[model samples]
Target: QLDAVPSFRMAVHPHIGTRSLDLVSERDKVGFETVLTSAKLMIQEKLSVGSISAHLADKYNLFNNSVKKQREDLLGQISSVESGKAATSQSSKCSHVVGHQAACCIKFGSNIQFRASTPEERESVPPPISKERGLVVREETCDALLALLTGLKGDTCKTLCLETARNEMKNAGDDNSLICDLTLLSFVRHCVEMGAVALH
Candidate 1:
């Protein structure tokens, strides 16, 4: 199961936050190149009708499980290997490697965010004015997007996608409203193209 987890090399980007896995490395890069290639291919696979969301959800669960198993296995291996070595010398080496590896795994297993270091830095970042337009605007926008994406005509599907995105934006105090309609449309189109959402 641990081997089943897709392996992709990641590095922190200097600007525009962390890039997607596709932008991280070339196909010929070292370390688990085959795994990375297979992952990219799997992501490119087309989804059948009514299977897009389910397929992604299942993959998410699988990846989540795999990461958990990997962590457990890594720790177990560290423990077993250290048991036979000198306590003082092996302790420092194992701890350093394990700490670095564990940190890398945790970071890669989740979304990456760029945070401001100080109040001045925070102030330099622009606020989202559109979010202040009120929950009604969010609800309406989510309803419209949900209706277009799914055959369902109400708030039922709103919570599934659009609303959740809005809530996260709201919590982060980021105004996505200033984002141009064309860009937002492109995002939705990309989501559909990537099988993250399905249209009926």
Candidate 2:
């Protein structure tokens, strides 16, 4: 059984307020990267599907157990508060005084707004490497082109084959999303050329 470490719990619940959910803390990043690395190793070693299934089951069980513990703790707190209120009401009745119901709602701040940071604020953190930035741009462009060529046929299929060939040549060095997308597009184009109808 996997233990529920604080870092993993933080990964499970990263958001604290109205922060961008897409942005994760360094701890969450570490946890996710660890899991991803393990999964990659499992794939490379040709591990059985049941091995991966069991790994996923453990993670899910951790999440479910954490949620259950939180629910039980919350209910216990509510019960204690209600009992305290009932005792207060009883004492108030003996003294012929009115008892007030205590509000037990939890409040969260909603005043935060999202915005791009100023250059000065961004200066603290170093920018991504040029190669990394280039890779991201290339990946986005390839994804857009793939979306356009999703349902290619006839003249469109030929045009996409040419485009995919060009992209594959340009992206041959890097094994990134663009290369994957181009490969998929090339496969689809070949299938269409081979009299296979593109459905949807």
Candidate 3:
């Protein structure tokens, strides 16, 4: 209801004092002084608000500048790291070329097939999950959970799967089915490797 009302304020008008003493009464002088003091107070209030606003703006600018600096610093660090990685990769490729040339120079009986190292191969390596100290759910259990999660959103499935795995681990005390030692992430990785769940 209050919102419906127009926000209107009456303008302040300072009393004008007459220069002629004969025309000015004591009451008129008092009224003029009262209005003058009120006007001064209003001006002071406005100045106070302006000062506060300026102070707040300064603080905000300082904070914003700090955030920008931090972001720039982070981006710079990331670019340097990326450049370093690129240099390392280039060097490795050059070394590989040199090795290949040297191999060609050698009159080897037959061309030997060399397995190249890759990030995918490294990531696909399974963790050492043992029965004594690791949290491992049964493969069947994982498959079942994953089957239930089909058609669900990726994030929702991931979260739900993690939560379900945790619950299974907690409830799998003395159970022979869930006897392997694995962390939550390792369990998920295992599932991913087994094609039970697709990695996002």
Pairs that clash in candidate 1? 128-175
Q: Under the 3 Å rule for N, CA and C atoms, how many clashes does model 1 have?
A: 1
Rank all candidate structures by their TM-score, best first, as comma-separated numbers. 3, 2, 1
RMSD of each: 24.1, 28.2, 24.0
- In each prediction, how many residue pairs overlap at the backbone (N, C-alpha, C within less than 3 A)? 1, 0, 5
- Model 2 Cα displacement at 151 (Å)? 33
Q: Sorted by lDDT, highest first, which candidate order results?
A: 3, 2, 1
Per-residue lDDT for 1-200 in model 1, tens only? 22455344443233323555656565334444565666667656644555777876787678657656555654454344333234334323332111122122221112211111223332333343455221222342454444343432223233223334434455655545533333233334333322333221
Best by TM-score: 3
Clashing pairs in 2: none
lDDT of 3 by residue, 54-101 (tens): 987888678657666544544454344435345345334432211223
Which segments of candidate 1 are over 4 A away from where they belong? 1-6, 9-32, 44-49, 53-133, 136-200
State each model's CA lDDT, in order. 0.38, 0.38, 0.40
